[model samples]
Target: MEQSTTIEIKDNSFARQFETIIPEGLLTVEYSFQERKIFLTKINTPDEFQDEIFLDNLIRTILDNAIEQRLKVVPTYPRIVQFFKKNPQYKELLPPGIRI
Candidate 1:
């Protein structure tokens, strides 16, 4: 199904997470920072909201933010690592000499 709704993500830096509120519930991408690298540690999505389009939009927003901030991404979460594997274009955001 086509997702007509725009995915809006809020970066709660104090909580070290990116959050979005949907009808289903709150979704979040938890993370930590070490120098230029942001370690994406976990992704929490409500069961009802766990669909491919929603997840991809969420991840894409995070990647876009990381790009704007010029921060290297370190996908510590297995799901995010898998995402980078599938979306090779995002691999350039990874720290040099690192592989998914």
Candidate 2:
């Protein structure tokens, strides 16, 4: 059976910043201001080519690329270092199938 997963981002500000960088024609994303969360839904097509493995890989690639781009926008090394310090769990928090 195919399963869906939800990733919850605790930082509302980061969520807003993220939407700007996501590429078009990828997964469908919905944002909830009241809940302060972004919802991503995998678009499944009836075509036989659209299988579970394909959908999983597509989501992984898109999220990995988005995170990499966001890391580049960090203004300075000091800021990045400080961020990591405050959120030591960041290294562990990285999305599944992503390499830092």
Candidate 3:
């Protein structure tokens, strides 16, 4: 029998961050509101689960959450830019005017 993989994403209001939890571990993306800018800080994903497919899906999920909350995001992590650079198809998931 094949076991289903359950990935859960949550917004931690007190911490001002978004969290994605899976069997491997937790992934966190922090954000802050400054005037018209929404600063999306570090993205911490489990080292073991940093494969391309996983990273792509995870990033997409985070971006979707941000849109649902009507928040503009500025992804500060270099990896995010790298991911989009390598897979331009996913660039549509990003909001307008995001540097990366």
Candidate 4:
């Protein structure tokens, strides 16, 4: 799973997900917001969009989005939980008492 050269993500509130359209298809992070928190529940990425850098950047971008909305993140998805574990700096975006 190699990544594209660039990515552009957008919030599709109607679908309750964040998405980026690429040549292969759509890369999406499914989510639900509640009580000032955003629960990252799932991710959909075609094989062609799967690269470490791309995944890192996508997760990082979502964290940045959470920061802008002043929302804490609850990573219910295993992949996002793993991401949080690997990137400690983003842990601050997690709610208090939450751990990867």
Model 4: clashing residue pairs? none
User: Model 4 off-target regions past 4 Å?
Assistant: 1-6
TM-score-sorted candidate list, best first: 1, 4, 3, 2
On the 0 to 100 scale, the lDDT of residue 14 in model 1 is 98
Model 3: worst 10 consecutive residues (lDDT sum): 1-10
1-100: candidate 4 lDDT, tens digit per residue: 4353445788999999999876778889999988999999999988876566777778888888789989999999999999899888898998989977
* RMSD versus native structure for model 4: 3.3
**Residues 1-100 of candidate 2: C-alpha lDDT, one tens digit per residue:** 3354443322235433222122232233232222322223223233434444444433444344446644322112243334334544444433344343
Best by lDDT: 1
Query: For this target, which candidate reaches the highest TM-score against the unseen true structure?
Result: 1
| lDDT of prediction 2 | 0.35
| Number of the candidate with higher lDDT, 1 or 3 | 1
Q: Which stretches in model 3 have alpha-carbon errors above 4 Å?
A: 1-7, 86-100
Go through the candidates in order and give each one's C-alpha lDDT.
0.88, 0.35, 0.67, 0.87
Candidate 1 residue-wise lDDT, 6-77, digit = tens: 678888999999999978899999999999999999998888775777787788889988999999999989
Q: Give each model a TM-score.
A: 0.89, 0.29, 0.64, 0.87
Q: Please report the TM-score between candidate 3 and the true structure.
A: 0.64
| Residue pairs whose backbone atoms clash in candidate 1 | none
Clashing pairs in 3: none
Residue 3 displacement (Å), model 1? 7.4
TM for candidate 4 is 0.87
